[model samples]
Target: MPRPPLPDDVAELFRRPNPAVVAVLLPSGAPMSVATWYLVEDDGTVLLNMDAERARVSWMREHPEVALTALEEGSWYTHVSIRGRVVRWEEDREKALADIDRLSRHYGGQDYPTRDRARISCWVEVTHWHGWGAAKAD
Candidate 1:
């Protein structure tokens, strides 16, 4: 079946580097959540990046389920939570680096710092969402 497209407001929320968190499950069946940067693709899939060798990367590779939350910069009351899975994982060095740079520009004052560590980029398809304000659930 086809997936639903992200609404304009939810898409805008993701456009920001605004505070965001991602939760991935551990091998022990516990949840591991962390703050990070994210973006929305043209098809409404979510984009996230991390160090290629990070524990989260390993966990995600084995178990794609994830829940991500994004909150407005200045308001704690406004937020969006997405429950989904990594639909696409990209390891191409150039593409991965570019994605990180794009996210850095959103949150960081500049492009992501150049580093020797390889990067992994994941595209998440939104399966469900619950939020407030414009992102509010039906």
Candidate 2:
């Protein structure tokens, strides 16, 4: 099986603005998951942003490993899951702000609703991935 982005069929599912849930490890090594907005970059990396004050930001900084499952909108069974690590963390509020705006436009068709809060962004380098349902690996 291919790693990370896989081929176009599986990758295509991620390109859409689908609902996604990201899972990360807590300090106790237990898994925690939260629904989040994500973007698939041209190079196949995943982009994610969060409020700087959120605990998940600190948790991700402490444990870079993460898994994201992107489900095709309106068709939950068709999905792709990627296991990856945070390759870069962007704390520059300006850059984070811009990235979040881009994500909001992709997901909600407008700029991020809140600008008062600082944002942080992370780039995930997918290491392994697989798909299920219509996107299932052959």
All candidates: TM-score: 0.88, 0.95
Among residues 3 or more apart in sequence or in different chains, the pairs in candidate 1 whose N, CA or C atoms overlap within 3 Å are: none
lDDT of 2 by residue, 23-85 (tens): 998988899999999999987889999988999888888999999999999999999999999
Clashes of 1: 0
Quantify all predictions' global Cα lDDT against the true fold: 0.82, 0.89
State the lDDT at 33 in candidate 2: 99
Q: In model 2, which runs have C-alpha deviations exceeding 4 angstroms?
A: none
In candidate 2, which residue pairs clash?
A: none
- lDDT at 130 for candidate 1? 73
lDDT, model 2, position 103: 94
Model 1, position 88: C-alpha lDDT score: 96
